[model samples]
Target: MLIDHFPVLGLRVRTPRLELRYPAPDELAALADLAVEGIHDPDTMPFGNPWTELPPDQLARRVVQRHWKTLSELRPDSWALNLAVFLDGVPVGVQEVEADDFAIQRQVHSESWLGLRHQGQGIGTEMRAAMLHLAFAGLGADEAVSVGYVHNHASLAVSRKLGYAENGIGRGVSRGKLALEQRFRLSREAWQEHRSVEATIEGLEPCLSLLGAGEE
Candidate 1:
């Protein structure tokens, strides 16, 4: 029998209009559909990772595999908290907050994507703020970081709104092409100073220990 993992199964974080959580069995299907439908225009590259270049179907499969692999492996060194971004009960996208050796890093990195239809709604900003709350307030992280292509103004704008300051720039290859990326960081102090969103977390207690926290 599969021992139900409460930490993974019961995680949840919420903002005014959205709830970010680990997808339950029923919700996971919906999340997969959202990925299959495509998060952005096929012609546009929004991520530093070239995995987004796959054909629509392949991209969808990868999304499903990611959810499964993360759960099955349950590794301590690398783990990703994949939250299905819901707006008014509909699956609109995926928000991934991740870390490597989080106990040591004391930092988390974020990545997210909304369907093309959902772009320009300010949902991105609110969603990102929700994750920030989880990292800083919920998990006691020292800082949070995110990156975007230099030309992706919308993403960079969202990061700026969430109090992320430009850290530096780096060149990397994506799909065999050199790309310039702007890295941004938000220290706990900056997050406290600039936090604006009102958030509440539910169903997180069971997972608190997994967050590398010493005590509740």
Candidate 2:
């Protein structure tokens, strides 16, 4: 019944090893707890924002708060869907896809993070592949883009493996210092060409209207 109203909650994206969905309360807690343990190396700031730099408690609170905040602000023209990432039914991280004026632009930008323990073993790349499928194939998006810190090889590697080519470079301030960023873009054709992970999406039809993607 709840899903009947918020069909986005019913949506699911599955890859070879990960399942991503609008997180239920308990799952969101698990995801938050995962963030408390850690995300990335403290020595280097990989994110453009210093979210992970907060104390563990503050960071965990931010994790849960951010998810709930997004839920309250959904709109057809501008919206973000932050899905909790799970491996073997255990929450491990988060993946977010967002767009402003999506109906007109037909483009989506994405970002994600994994618990420190889950950073390797190809999970990050596979989970991202799932979202790329959801965008280009499931939602008819024309292009997808992401910004990664130049030294964030892990994030950039995931983009590269998923067929994202460098769009350009920009400089930003992160952790009170200058940071170089690489903008990456992937077209539908490119996604199809380099997509290595197989992904399956479920229950997306009912949310198409909400996403303004029904016309596609």
Candidate 3:
């Protein structure tokens, strides 16, 4: 049987050539290896945090730790769902859907990283669209938000493709360094109006309450 905590095991979102899902153990191991191989190079920081500056093994450990922590501390109010992105049956990177005070916030946020080798194939946009489908259609979210470092044009472009409008810019300290972040938001109505990908879900029934919603 699929794991109970993450019924999203069987739940998948597919594009013409990519598949997204919560990784099972074997798949998660493969994903860890992908991270080990390198998602970002040491000198370049696609993410605002300097976390990528860590050695490859450390970076790989961090990826495993995130999955472990999320499952161990599963909660309704705040949670992180990490889906391994696979292209042609091989792990390429991770996509995350997260929320804080989700039971009350009625909102969610998206984040993701594609292995440097897989960066420009339009996979980012489709993966994000799939997450929005789950947030707005599956979880009944009112809005979904995302933030990109001011200089991360590629991420900003993905948000724009999904019809996310600029909310504002804010300053924050990341990895002990100051950074500027550009916030973006998309309402349920806006998502429906602008979405273009075809996404479907399965195995969400048992986990629906975890999302703070009743079956629709």
lDDT of 3 by residue, 1-216 (tens): 536645655667676677788776887887777777666655446676665666878877788888788766656777778878888988888888998877777899977888777878898888888888888888889999999877778888989988999999988665567778899999988999899998877776767677665544
Rank ordering of all candidates by TM-score, starting from the highest: 2, 1, 3
Count the clashes in each prediction: 0, 0, 0
Off by over 4 Å in 3: 41-43, 174-176
State the C-alpha lDDT per candidate: 0.80, 0.89, 0.79
lDDT of 2 by residue, 1-216 (tens): 877777889899998789999887888888888888989998888877788878878988899999988877877888889999989999989999998887889999998999999877898898899999999989899999999999999999999988999999999888888898999999989999998888899999998888878786
User: Please, what are the lDDT tens digits per residue for candidate 1 over residues 1-216?
Assistant: 232464666677888898887676777777766666666666657776767667877777787788787666654567778788889988788888888877778899998988777778889998899999988888788999998988778899999988899999989765578879999999999999999999988766666566555352
Question: What's the CA error at residue 209 for candidate 1, in Å?
Answer: 2.5
User: Residue 120's C-alpha lDDT in candidate 3?
Assistant: 81
TM-score preference between candidates 2 and 3, better one? 2
Number of the top-ranking candidate, with lDDT as the measure: 2
- Candidate 1 residue runs with Cα over 4 Å from true position: 1-4
- Residue clash pairs of candidate 1: none
Model 3 lDDT vs. the true structure? Answer: 0.79
Clashing pairs for predicted structure model 2, backbone only: none
Let me know the TM-score candidate 3 reaches against the reference structure.
0.90
Worst 10 residues of 1 by lDDT: 1-10
